[model samples]
Target: MTARTLVMLAVLAIAAGTGWLSRGWFEDAQRLTALEAAQAAASQALARESVIAGVVEARLATLDTHQRVIDRGVIREIQKPIYRRVCLEPDAVRLLNDAAAGRAPDPADAADPLPDDAAAVE
Candidate 1:
């Protein structure tokens, strides 16, 4: 081979080696981003679940107090408000509305007044 061919081959070999070594770096970066996203989702879910559980516990406690304690008509009995403050963002509201909205009640779902269209067509 000529000197030029040898130099070109050497350059190609070096580039291939560099690419092979760098491949792991790209894969590791991808894995790291995915892991971080998963962790964030997990943390958010945990916090949301904990808050819901606490609300349930508080409601239960309120009910229990109401049943167990016979309050004398003394105006001294302070009643704590046990209201659930649900603040949904626009996106959250849209999601909830979408989920709650069922498919429009099709006429077929009700008692069929007439022979089925499919049957008539057949």
Candidate 2:
């Protein structure tokens, strides 16, 4: 072979070796890009879930505040002078107890008259 052909072959061999060695570097760059994308997606998902949790916590806090207000109102109403002075008959007391216990009270019990002493106290 002529010197010119030998030099050309040498150049081709060097180029092929460089390309083969650089293939790993290219593959590593692609893998790094894919990992970065996956990490970004996971971060977005975590942020969305955190927002949902915050909303749920706020709703629960609102419900608790509303419940406290209702409880206070009920306490104030029960402490009124009229309610304090009132006395319930045995049948009426029984009906109230049954109602409070989530049972259906007898209609007949509701129609019973208050005692004479209970009426005088009112």
Candidate 3:
């Protein structure tokens, strides 16, 4: 073979070998880019979910505080002494019925006289 022809073949052979060796590097770079994009997407989704979880936690804390307040009020009411009426006065019964029906009790009901025994209980 001529010297020029052999040198041309050597250059071509080196070029081909370099291209073959670099193929794997190019493929690895593409895979790394795709993985980075996927990781970024997952990070954004996690941030949004964390925000939602914090809101839910705050709402639950508020609800728990309200329930505690209601429980304290209930305990206070239950601890108060309860007075039992030995007899239900007619006007008092009417007033209770009116209150239960969401109506204002008559002013006259307050002026009505109680039985003699009612004062003894007090």
Candidate 4:
């Protein structure tokens, strides 16, 4: 063969070999890029879920504090009027005198209702 022809044939052979060897590498690179994109999407979704959870926790804490305030207000309102009624009753003076003398107050003069469990223990 002529020198020129031999060199040309050698070049073509090398080019074909390189292309064959690199075909799998190019396919693997495409798959790796797709995997990276999927991972990034999953990370963003997890971050959004955490933010939603934090907001719900904060709202629940606020509700708990408001409930405590309402409970305290109701207890105060119920107790205040009962104290005022006891103070203004016409028998208040006599009741104080009997208590100071250590005599047992009559059941009819009791300010509060009797317990349902009072007879249960006997």
Clashing pairs in 4: none
| RMSD, every candidate, angstroms | 20.6, 21.1, 23.6, 22.7
Write the candidate numbers in order of decreasing TM-score.
1, 3, 2, 4
Local distance difference test, candidate 4: 0.82
Residue-by-residue lDDT tens digits, candidate 1, 1-122: 99999999999999999998899899999999999999999999999999999999989888733346667785565555433224544454554565589534444434434555755753
Given candidate 2, what's the lDDT at residue 74?
A: 41
Would you estimate the TM-scores of all the predictions? Answer: 0.47, 0.44, 0.47, 0.41
How well does candidate 2 score on lDDT at residue 52?
100
**Weakest lDDT window of 10 consecutive positions for candidate 2:** 64-73
Q: Per-residue lDDT of 1-122 in model 3, one digit per residue for the tens?
A: 99999999999999999998899899999999999999999999999999999999989888733333334444444442234553776677788899899999766657756677977955
In angstroms, give how far residue 58 of model 3 lies from its true place. 0.7
List candidate 4 segments past 4 Å from native.
1-13, 65-122
Query: lDDT of each structure?
Result: 0.75, 0.82, 0.82, 0.82
Across 5-96, the per-residue lDDT of candidate 2 in tens digits comes to 99999999999999988998899999999999999999999999999999999898887433333344444334665576357666767877
